[model samples]
Target: MRKRDLEIIKHLEMFRVMSRDDIVDLHFKHLKNPIGNANTVLKRLVRDGQIEVSTMHSPYLYFPVGNHIKKNSTKIPHYLKLVQVYKDLCEIEPPTEFIIEPQYKKGLAEPDIYCVFKGTPLFIEVQNSIYSSKQMEDKIKRYELLKQSELVKPFPTIIMITNTRYAIESDQIKVIQTPSIAHLIHKANEDSNTPPPPQPIKTNGNITFKL
Candidate 1:
């Protein structure tokens, strides 16, 4: 199997589902013709039985061969939002790489995405709802407790991306609202004094369709 095909399978197995556009954005953004190349690859993958597609939605979604996608499920919408955040991060310049739901030996806490930027490991959480003061405190406490144990060397920067305008800040964590995903990425990059990523060069010749 090709490396891209393997990556797609691993992503589907980890996230359960993703739309065609999501896949294109996340993996092929650097290509001269991203969407066109992605469509060609996806078609070949579907024909080879390595992946499957669902036409129940407008843009259509792709899934692992053996997995059944529940289009009507409430969880799917939230999952897609998380995927979008991942996709947006992928599109950012300077090329941010992420590990989904990191595993720790200390406990069972799994943050949505663990990304490292400018040598800083950041735990990013996507919050779709408001949290009570107590609820928020408990989460902070849990992270603090984990840090104190020193089970994971070098404490990570915890960042919460939320839909709410209100935010929380402390020595242990920082919360930023999600007015725009690209803006959020730019803010983080600026705060770290990291340079923006170079733009992809547009091809003047005919775009090749790779499968």
Candidate 2:
């Protein structure tokens, strides 16, 4: 930074923001002999190319010539935190190129982690909501589509993982369903009288029916 540029920054850092009037008034308070105006200092900085006058975010704020705050909070961004939790629990590492908002024709589906497991691609959606029928239907429909070849193969195993802020376990975790698709379909349709004929339920000879 130029000698004067550094001095200006030290002044700006004193608060979240500063206006020309504030700086001019501060000048009078500091030097006791005011330049009597802020334009002089601003124009000087502008001429030296130490700062640029920006009018985008706020009305006329001065910014460094070409610097930006790239890095942010270490705690995950709010939108990704829940998704990250799913990845952590599932022990599934998401691909770097995976789309956070993967495009699906039916709706705006935001899978927490669109990654592959055991060479099979999967779509994991997380719900931090109190379970509802509509939410349940939406979650299962994706699976039904996958089952009927209505969707694509290596068909994304829809993982609907839920969280109960409290430890008392209930029917929250839909992501970890039984190994068999038939059983999963059965449980999914258990609430309704007629679901449909069970299709093929491929398994690796072992399944978890705990739910």
lDDT of each: 0.72, 0.48
- lDDT digits (tens) for residues 165-197 of candidate 1: 443545754444555567777786787896555
How many residue pairs clash in all the candidates, one count each?
A: 1, 0
Model 2, 1-211: lDDT tens digits are: 6565575665444222344444454444456444543566677887887666544433245544553422232322333343343334333333443334355556434455566644656676555456666666665555554445544444565654555322222232234533332343456567577655555553687543432
List the RMSD of every prediction in angstroms.
Answer: 13.6, 18.6
Q: List the residue pairs that clash in candidate 2.
A: none
Task: TM-score for candidate 2, please give it.
Answer: 0.35
lDDT of 1 at 40: 92
